[model samples]
Target: MEEKIKDVLDAYTFQTTRVCRGRGAFICDTDQGMKIVKAYHRSPQRLEFEQLVKYTIRDRGYYYVDQLLPNKEGQYLNNNKDGQMYTVRDWFEGRECDVKNAADVLAAVRQLAVLHMLMRRCDLSEDRVEQFSFQDTRQIFLKRRKELRAIYSYIRQKKQWNDFEKLYMQLYSDCMQEADAALSELNQFDFDGLRKKALDERTLCHGDFNYHQVILNRKYTAVVNFDKMHYDIQVKDLYQFLRKVLEKNNWDSSLGTMIMDTYLSVRTLSEEERRVLYAMLTFPEKFWKISNRYYNSRKSWISSVNYDKLCRFKKTEGQRQDFLNIFKYAFIF
Candidate 1:
């Protein structure tokens, strides 16, 4: 692996003293500074899209992104002998974000808001946006609801119940009931009307925004990995980060409120945006995800850890509801 990375590194003109793995990518000590060498398997078109995103962020006076480095051949990507694609970017000095810490969480969310303001200026066609439909509350809920029904049936047919299955059955009714109510509300909402308004003011979402992707030094120094960058309502990133932090904070309403307030402090959200966020927060995503992973895993036997996660989800259900209620009312039109 070192040799392969070294070979890729040779393509660059930088003088390197040492190279080692840094988290999910390779890092090197170059005369210029630290540089990250990462590889991906994306299509040429998607690569072009990300290339556009890189410059868009940089040009907007934001330098926190993983700026792609062109090799000696003047290409952003190096297709090696093994057919693997790699890219090198200047690395920032920092540590991964600590989601549990309120300050760190606030810093990351503020960075996201800044990124969104820059990305919203980019002019990408609507269809080019991956997961664009997810911005629509109706599509998001209806799709998850259908997937949940299938998983519910899959577990019901099993004669022998696993521990996960038992707890799943116990909570299935409540989860489904919540999902149904969300769907009903979504159905009555003017999805097309709100969606059109959102589209008129769309921006890019850090599709995989989380503590891991964020780097902190006093403040958030960088947000690495735009591999999941997509054209969507920017709140997608905020909603995702909120969900993750809320789970870690035991779904505490105060923490949830603090995070939301912190993010809005940097970027204001409109009523339509808040409504979409509300629907997303209200969805039974955790339950569906656990069931999805279990059913999707090729392994015949299920992992007990998944059951533990489901139990934790059940234990924290009340707190999540409380937080959601607070958010819903505070933002209610």
Candidate 2:
């Protein structure tokens, strides 16, 4: 960790040092500070993509993000070193956005709208920024299904497996089959036409837009985490926000409607986009598959966490169906 900090500060020569870990490595000062250092233990490609996103947002005069620190080489990130990709940015103190308040929720919608608009203007091809299309999402689901099923089979064969474990294995299999069917239907849909329509109609999108990514200061809301930023359907981001709100609270249809209404008021969605929203609801299932693969591989700690959350949410099947019903209302499926 100390070595990672040195790599991050190699460009700035900062005096203070503190580290906090979340999705990636973050270095800050012990006291109130002005700068932040973020390092990823992944490939340089990811860091480069993040830097590109930061540059794009900053160039458009969006102050929601911390400014990328430039080295003497005039690069915002250091890629010369192997196994360490790091960049520094100006730090802003803030808190997470409030979800209960209607005004706060509307504000988040507006912010997402602006973000989507900005992403629409970006030159994604130059940065090798690939959009997560329906095809890619389907492929991920299929891959995850295969992996999870293998894990379940292994668990079932184990001598020490209990009744609860066996029940969960059956549940996992059932969910995987459901996801597979949904993905197959999604793959057969007119995704090409949908993609062209979405691109031509909608603005830029923060692919992983959610309340957690939005930080609230006294009077302004700032968005962070551009790592997953991409050019895709605007509803993709909108649905992500809606899903979180449903997950956090009971399935609140009014809240979901208000968010959609606010976003559409800012940036209108086409009939085709509305039709594609149901297909998009299945996108989160891809992430579940990815998470399951990671858990099975022992590569991520999220499997246990996500499983617990899903179990808690599963207690209210009607609520789950109600939330899903929102997507059905949007799409023909």
- Candidate achieving the largest TM-score: 1
lDDT, candidates in the order shown = 0.80, 0.63
Off by over 4 Å in 1: 125-137, 197-202, 298-300
- How many Å off is the CA of 95 in candidate 1? 0.4
Candidate 1 global lDDT? 0.80
Model 1 root mean square deviation, Cα atoms: 2.3
* TM-score of candidate 1 to 2 decimals: 0.92
- Listed in order, each prediction's TM-score against the native is 0.92, 0.73
Q: Name the lDDT of candidate 2.
A: 0.63
Tens digits of lDDT, candidate 2, 14-72: 55556665445464664336566676465566666667767877788787875666776
Model 1 Cα lDDT, one tens digit per residue, 1-333: 477776688889998888888777898889988899988777767777887777878877988787888889888788667878888888877888888888888888888887878887576666665434344556777888888788778888988888888898899899998888777665666757665654666666778999898988764468988887765667778888899888888998987888888778878888767877887788888888887787787547889889899999999999989988999988765
